[model samples]
Structures are given as structure tokens and as C-alpha cells.
Target: MKEYSVVPNKDVTGWMVKIEDVAPEKLYDERDAAIAEAEEIAQKNKPSRVIIMDQNHEVEEERTY
Candidate 1:
């Protein structure tokens, strides 16, 4: 199954949507927007999962489609 994660940037200034097997990465200015984008992709690729990480890089939440 495919997977995606929304993680905080190293500087903690932004959020990143990390999609498995997809490079370059997707950055977002807002946390909500990043999560929304991740959800969109998760919905598109059903049977996948979306992981949300906290600023400390720990898993905060997860959702499966």
C-alpha cells in the first residue's frame, strides 16, 4: 500500500508532505493545508495511509483510507 506523512520541517517553520516513492517533497506554509493536501492524496490513493508527525518528529496521528 502507498503511504504519506506530514512532518514538521527541520527548522519547524513549515510542514512537509512526504509521499512514499515520490521525491522532491511537498512543502506547505500552514499545517492545516499540509494535512489537507495529504488527505487529498490519501483519498486518491485509497487503501493507503497518512501519518502526521509532531514538531519533535513523533507520530501524532494516523489515518487510513
Candidate 2:
């Protein structure tokens, strides 16, 4: 199964949506925006999931598509 993650960017300037451990697909200034986009992408690719992370870079929540 595939996995999409909404995590803080390395520099902590913003959040990003990445597929698995690969490079980020997009970036967002707000966490909510990143989560929304990740969910949308996860839904399009069923059997996948979205892993939401907090500012501390810890897993906060997870949603399966």
C-alpha cells in the first residue's frame, strides 16, 4: 500500500506532502492546508493512507483511504 505524509519541512519553514520517504510533492505554509492536500491525494490513490505529523515532527493522527 502507498502512504502519503503531511510533515514539517526540513527547515521548519512550512509543511509538505510526501509519498512514503520520497521527496515532497508540495509545500504549504499552514498545517491544515498540507493535511487537506494529503487527504485528497490519499483518497485518489485508495488502499493508501495519510500520516499527519505535529510541529515536533511526531505522528499526530492517521487516516486511511
TM-scores for every candidate against the unseen true structure: 0.91, 0.92
The digit string of per-residue lDDT tens for model 2 on 1-65 reads 89999999878889999999699998899989999999998889899999999888899999998
Give candidate 1's whole-model lDDT: 0.89
TM-score of 2: 0.92
Please report, in order, the local distance difference test score of every candidate based on alpha carbons.
0.89, 0.91
- Among all candidates shown, the one with the greatest lDDT: 2
Alpha-carbon shift of residue 6 in model 2 (angstroms): 0.5
The alpha-carbon deviation from the true structure for residue 25 of candidate 2, after best TM-score superposition, in angstroms, is: 0.4
Per-residue lDDT of candidate 1, residues 1-65 (tens digit) = 88999998889899999988365278888999999999999999899999999999899999999
